[model samples]
Target: MAFTIPEGLHPDLNPLAWMVGTWRGKGRGEYPTIPTFEFAQEVTFNHDGRPFLNYFSRSWIIDAEGEIIRPGASEVGFWRVKEKNVLEVVISHNTGISEGWVGQFDGPKIQLVMDQGYSAPSAKIVTAGVRLYGLVAGELFYAYDMAAEGQELQAHIWSTLERQVD
Candidate 1:
């Protein structure tokens, strides 16, 4: 499955155009502090003739039979291309967490280092994080590593998502 590059996109946003679509897939979640669980996730990326890509994601905790037991997590964000190879991302989550990430991009992949992080009083704290996301044969391949709850940086989540036609 090859992702199509969106036409008439903002000149500065071309490199990230491959992400301009909806994607859905399944992923696993695990942490030393909590039990492992499986989740069904959907992520959408869209642009409005601007330099930034709008982002949204929603996930659900699922049983072994793939029945949604409850809503899991969700976030909204923007991916901004500042320079040819420089990008910035700001994400706000319904889970009471927000993050700012800076990274470099080479059309297909983006590697980010958390430059700023925030959490609301009612939320859990994530000290820092690293993310690497890219298009692998048209699939959205992404992963996260983070430090939280005194657990040193470790794999937090990873998923391979296929483009959604609608």
Candidate 2:
């Protein structure tokens, strides 16, 4: 399907206009500190005539049959695109971890490396991370690798989501 640039989107965000909609899909997650799991997720990227995109994502643990078993992770953030496709992101998780990421986008693909992070007294500290997002076969493919608790960065979660038509 052809994509139309979202009306009123700031010129600076045109490169990311393809992501300005809600997407839904399932993903798998695993970490050295926890067992592998499956989750259903909904992610949205929207803007209000601004230079940045507002991002939100929520997930729920799912059973083998794809039924939601319970709530999973959620995060809120903003994505900003600068000159030369340079990208900056700031995200805060429900678990009290907040991070700053810097990267660049080439066409439909984006690669971000964590620059720093902050954790609350009760939250786990993630020392480093890498996130990859791309448009593949008309779907959004997302993946993340993270280092935390003295462990080296490795695969953590990944998902494929179809854009929702509204």
**Considering summed lDDT, which 10 consecutive residues are worst modelled in model 2?**
1-10
Best by lDDT: 2
Clash counts for the predictions, in order: 0, 0
Top-TM-score structure, candidate number: 2
lDDT of 2 by residue, 1-166 (tens): 7789999999999999999999999999999899999999999999999899999999999999999999999999999999988999999999999999999999999999999999999999899999999999999999999999988999999999999999
Candidate no. 1 TM-score: 0.93
The TM-scores of all predictions, comma-separated, are 0.93, 0.99
lDDT of 1 by residue, 28-51 (tens): 878899898989999999988887
Model 2: CA > 4 A from native? none
> Can you give the lDDT of residue 147 in candidate 2?
99
lDDT of 1: 0.88
